[model samples]
Target: MSRIQANLLLTLIALIWGSAFVAQSHGMQELGPMMFTGLRFLVGALVVLPLAWREWNYLAGRQLALNRDDGLKILGLGMLLTLGAAMQQIGIKYTTVTNAGFLTALYVPLVPVLGWLLLRQLPHWSVWPGALACLVGAFLLSGAQSLEIGLGDSWVIASALPWGLHVLLIGRVADRMAAPFLVACGQFFVCGLLALIWGLLFEPFSGAGIQAAATPILYTGILSVGVAFTAQVVAQRYAHAADAAIVLSSETLFAALFGYWLMGDRLAPAGLAGCALILGSLLVVQLLPLLQPAKTSSEVLPIK
Candidate 1:
């Protein structure tokens, strides 16, 4: 797929995830965070299992071997996914869908920074300004002017770190692996297994609670996890990680809209301004690379 197609796919994923935020919020009403997370992702894993098997068969027919290192990386991604998802799930219980949605987007700026720091993939100069804007926006959105944030918002903010790392890791994995469904399946299964273990050990279990959350679990599991995330793994193969983050961040807008319509979420003026600033910064960050003139091989100077 072309970059444009990849971006469009990411946008669709954003919509699914944004709407899924409402389901997630409702899910916590009936189930503990770990239990809800575990059930949804395990369902997701089952949904993807058939497709992953087909992919494995295709690879086998071609006599291609999956690398051991890539398998390890997939496991690592599962851990990050679990941490990020669990934190966001827990946070959504205390915060409005609007707040949770916007705060979760903290990963947009983080992707480029983490890329630069860990992978030595230098971001455009615009990244610093954009990152600053995102931080200020998060502050305003979180009501930090009162000099404190609620526990939910704090968890949402913390989730961004792992979320950013997850995005970067997916980019790396996509570059190395041709089987997107397999990658998605492995991560979902591992995350589901770990979350289920945690839930069983620490969180109370009730079949009625699961039944109460059945609709949400199925919606998020089938569409959000099964379809959207797998699509992301495929799309990122053709898109840059930073660029994909910006597009995925549009989910914040969708979340706000859905929250307002479905859950009666209304943001204060400060929160509105914060959202605008974040969206503007994302646009600037996304466009800066395209705006800058590309240096020719001769124009490029060696870094000491």
Candidate 2:
């Protein structure tokens, strides 16, 4: 659709994703990180499978061959997503909600840089300034007190790398397949399968944790994964990868605001400044293309 519609879509996605952050954090109250993740993906996969199946009709006959490049690409993308989600969910347990929210949002800046190095294609000129602003916002938002990076901090760092890669993977594959199917079925299956293996092998899957997580886990499984992700599939289809990254990054703003409003967390001085930078960043990024007279949808219940 039009750019106006895209902005609206991204905004709604941001709001949903922001609210779900609280859900994800709460869901872990009873579930082990891995068990929670596995169960969520399993439920999400079941939710989206029918939609993905509808898209399969487009790939008839030999197009569906296992040896096809699309098959391999989709598989590889799924693996990276699995890695990112595992690190993020577990890392969230150790980090403050504020840090967890902004740290993960760093992937917005990471996308353009990774795309440049790997694809030999630089992002729009807006990316550099946006990255710097985001970095400053990150520093302030982090409240480092002297740049200390703890275990949880390190996990957040690790999570950014894969998430950036995940965006890159989606960008490459976006033009080649059914966006919804790739998002709903292909990538998710990979995530589900790998998480299943990880949970079974390394995690405690006792009934206590699983049952404890029943309500929150159920919230995460259905709304966060199932509904939010469907929005992402549709929305991302309408924008370029880098632009999509910025729009998705709006989650940081929403998350911080939501935390304060819902959890009684007050905004510190740094929080106030960080929030401004985020708002400024959003305004600049959104207006850049239009000011230059150039450039740039779904049930997409986007997650991040």
Candidate 3:
């Protein structure tokens, strides 16, 4: 797909995940964080199994086995995914959906920084301004005037590091692996299995609790994990990781809207201005490349 198309797909994923913040908040009302995370991701794994099988068959037709190195990389991705998801899930229980959503966007700035530090990949010049704008916007949208943070907000902030690394890893491996669905399946399974084990060990289990959270589990599992994440893996194949992060930052806006409408969360005037800044930053990031003079092959940096 073209870069524009990939970005559009990322935007859609953002919307799905934004709405999922509400579902996640509701889901934990009856279930422990680990239990809810385990169930939803396991359900997501099942939802994507058929696609993963097709991908496996296609690879077999080409006489290719899954690369050992790639398998290890995917395992690492699963660990990071689990870390990020678990922190966010736990944090949502104590924070409003609006706060969780905006705070989680801390990853937008983190992605480009991680890419540079770990892979020595330098993003386009425009990315810096856009990322700064996104960071400031998220801060304003979160409505925190002081450095002190709540426990839930702190957890969500902590999750940003792993989430940023997850994006970089996906961008690094997605094209080379050429099995986005399979990668999605493997990560989901690993995350689910680990979470389930953790939950069973320390958290109480009740079938009725699962039933009570059924709607949220199904919605997030099917849409957020199954469809949106897989699409992210595919889209990142064509899009730069930094660019994808900025585009996906739109989730903060969507989450605010959904939280206001569904969860009775309200944003102040500053939050509304923050929303406009986010939109402006997104436009600048996406449009700058198209407006710039085309670079020669040697002048272009390979997507990392």
Candidate 4:
């Protein structure tokens, strides 16, 4: 693919993912967060299984075996994914999609900080400024007067830590895994199963609820998880790292647009400012290396 085509693919992926925020919020009207999360992830798992199997078969043809250690790593990744997805769904129930989109972008800044703390690697100087901007943006967006943040925004903010950890884990294990698609499938299966158990324990399951939520669930599960993710995997092979990041990070903008157009959601001026800062910070963090004269190229962070 040409760079332009690759970039368009990435942009499409971002659009799909951004619109999923609206889908998730709408789905909450029919099903509880736990049930919705469980069902969507289960559907996602089913959708991706064939692709993963195809990759697994190719690896097997090369005489590669997925070992016990890789299995454990995949399980760990799944657990983290489950937590992040659960928090996001629960937060969406109580927050506007606009708020959820910008807040979720916090993970972009949080990743380098987590890498520094966990691996003892120093972040580039730009990371510090980007992180600061995100912190300030989050504070303003939270609508805190004294020190109290809204419950839903708090959930979304807290979810960023787990997401950061998930990225770090992927960075550590991705190069070692024989089949990336298979690893993704294993993690999705684990996340789906865990959410399913939580739903069974705490939320009532209803066929009627599932039926009502079908459209939203299908959008999030099949398009967001299955198609968009696969497209990202393929497109990134042909895209410049920084170009892909810039395109994909427009997800917040798309989310706000979708929310406004579809549900008439609006943010206050302060909240809008916060969203701008957060988005700017993400760009700085992603493009910083490219701006530096001595740096060869930018590193590509994995998409959530």
Clashes of 3: 0
Question: Which candidate number has the best TM-score?
Answer: 4
User: After superposing candidate 4, which stretches have Cα over 4 Å from the reference?
Assistant: 293-300
TM-score of each prediction: 0.87, 0.83, 0.83, 0.96
Q: Rank the candidates by lDDT, best first.
A: 4, 1, 3, 2
lDDT, candidate 4, 1-304, per-residue tens: 8999999998998899899999999998988887887778778878889989998888888878688988999999999988898998899888889889889989887887898998987888888999899988988877677678888998998889888899878756766774777877788788888988888898876898889999998888888877787788888888988798799999999999999999798778888788889999999998886676676543335545
* Best prediction by lDDT: 4
Give residue 42's lDDT in candidate 2 (0 to 100).
Answer: 76
How much lDDT does each candidate structure score?
0.82, 0.69, 0.79, 0.84
Better of 3 and 4 by TM-score: 4
Question: Mind giving the per-residue lDDT tens digits that candidate 1 earns over 1-304?
Answer: 9989988888888889889999999988888999899999999999889999998999888987577887898899899999999999999989889989888877867877999999999988888999899888887887666878888999999999999888777756855687767877889988999998999899887899899999999999999888886676677778765567577768889999999999999888988988888888877876666554663111100000
lDDT tens per residue, model 3, 1-304: 9989988888888889889999999999899999999989999999899999999999989987688897898899888989999999999998789878877766755666787889898766777888888767766766778755567877887888888898778755666787877887888888898998899899987999999999999999999888886677678778865567467767877888899999999778887777677667765655565554673111111111
Clashing pairs for predicted structure model 4, backbone only: none
Tell me how candidate 1 scores on lDDT. 0.82
